[model samples]
Target: MVVGARLEGIQLSGIRKMFELTTERSVNLGLGEPDFQPAQHIRQALSDAVEKGYNKYGPTSGISNLREALANGARKYRSDITANDIVVTTGSTQALMITAQYLFNPGDDVLLPDPGFVLNVPQVRIAGARPLMYPLKQEHEFIPQVDDLEKLVTPKTVAIYTNSPSNPTGGVMSIEDIRAITQFAEDHDLWIVSDEVYDQIVYDREHQSFLGDYDKVIHINSLSKTYAMTGWRFGFLITKAPIIDKLSILNYYTIACPNVPTQHAALAAMTGPQEHVKQMVNEFKRRRDLIVDRLNRIDGIHCLVPKGAFYAFPKYDFNISALDFAMECARSDLICTHGSAFGDAGEGHIRFSYANSMDNINKGIDIFEEVCEKIKG
Candidate 1:
């Protein structure tokens, strides 16, 4: 039997399989998940929920308490959001899926950065929409050029997906850039899906969010990175009432509801001590400094220090493809993701995640340097 085109064409799992095949006893630095455990208070809250019999199905949009907490959290960063505007989902992934499904009709075009998150493009395609690519330039420090975005917009453009402190590249869009994009989206009546998963991981400047300026902005965020609650599968979408209602309906039919325990856990994550988050950010900063310093010293490797996310996307001077370079690194027992896994524009780079321990980061860089030298020689 022939598989569905959407299912057959998706290559994410293939990338995972490649990592599995090539990775040896080497340190695997490709994963972007936080190395820290969920905070003690959050875990205790989950345990307390279980003890209190909160294991039943939650409200489809998430538990009411969690929604309130998520809304409160959003208000700290952006104005004009409330509990009524929030829909808690399994993760930011589900939020993105629901947004795409609700906003885009078949044949509509969804704009995304060229070296953007791989999942966004396929999700748009699976929603029966065309994924229009907008190139983010290395010369521009990987920030999306508003001019390029303007060129990519079409009459059928329904939404533009942006990741600030972006994955792989770690480029954080400035407030000015965000203002221009929001103005453009407002002019064209397009939805802005801002994935702020790394919002808390920013290093240089305070994070700029589209929600502060546009009511139509759909802000997707999670406790996954900030609170080290990845396996808890907790995330929420912040948008206006009408959009929330639509996503809630789609969310109801899809998963019915997020797990009750996870909702309780997420509530704790929102209300719990924020010092853990600060500490993790500090550690990631240290690791970023270490990695950027080492990678830049390598003969043919040039890396830009990441401003936000815990990733360093570095260009390598070798004839081998990014995929092949990643494979070669794996043979040396050091696992890193090829930039091309994100998209075609990512071809000349490799993404090294600093979400690992300092020891692992140090060792991984040493191994990566050795591999690069061997290839260069």
Candidate 2:
């Protein structure tokens, strides 16, 4: 009874739970970060910043130069964007954490995607809002539609979270999908919380962001995935609202400020050579192709080729629950996520991250195939 009612139903993330179950022999596909090291120039920049004494507390809204650079990058999406639009945080995770709390009220409803990131549900709940899940059907290529939202929205609905190159499923929303969803939100007068953390890890085609399409968007991004600086934990939030002064004050009370040297390194990351970023994407593409092709060769599995991100989410014609299928894979010394860990829409699927080396990906798939055979019986 001592615990807050809002925290009552919340539990640990199923993704991290699978991760903790990893054994020394486990081929870990359960986690969600790149295996690549921080690029050479990025590392050098952090060293240089520390040597020059950037170790003290810095700006709460992030370093001015980094903010300017991010604003410049985002300006391509919206012409009027400037340094005033950014709020730097510990990570995109925190960006998400704070944004949900800032936007939602005690009784409001926020539409979310089913088979979406696990964090969306808890974040909204803790912020005292109800999460209304809209489905992304495989028949529709795992994209969200206005038709789906029609049933979910009510007068209490306040916002919707949009993820492109979505986690687990690796489904990217199309231009048409983006425009329609934006128009729907406009019609309903709801905030659009857009998470585009995997924006740069895309394959084959350019990924268009959802940020520029609407005025009510609260856009999120970070250096964690793009520069392989996950440990550095740098992220920023963007909005046209003059409310950043208020958000930064909240960020100051909440996170103090992002690490000083990491901010310096982030500056170099945005300004450094384009080669390392390109190389990382190319490597992920190789892994993406490898995992999808091999998983398809497994008789009962069907994986859609992901156009972006480092994940391969495949549906299998198995009688077992996704959690049980994942548990079976764990027994074989391989680790990946159960699809339902995302939501009910994900029940028959499993998610394999291709962020590991090719050797490990192959080894993981080999173990997964054995699990498939066991389930077939």
In angstroms, give how far residue 13 of model 2 lies from its true place.
0.5
lDDT for residue 81 in candidate 2, whole number 0-100: 88
- Separately for all candidates shown, the number of backbone clashes (residues 3 or more apart, or on different chains) is 1, 0
lDDT of 1 by residue, 159-204 (tens): 8999998987999988888988888889899889999999999995
lDDT string for model 2 (105-205, tens) is: 89999999999999899999999999999998777878997888998899999999989989978998877888999899999998899999988878887
User: For model 2, which pairs clash?
Assistant: none
lDDT of 1: 0.86
| Model 1 deviation from the true structure expressed as Cα RMSD, one decimal place | 1.6
By TM-score, how accurate is candidate 1? 0.96
Model 2 CA deviation exceeding 4 Å by range: none
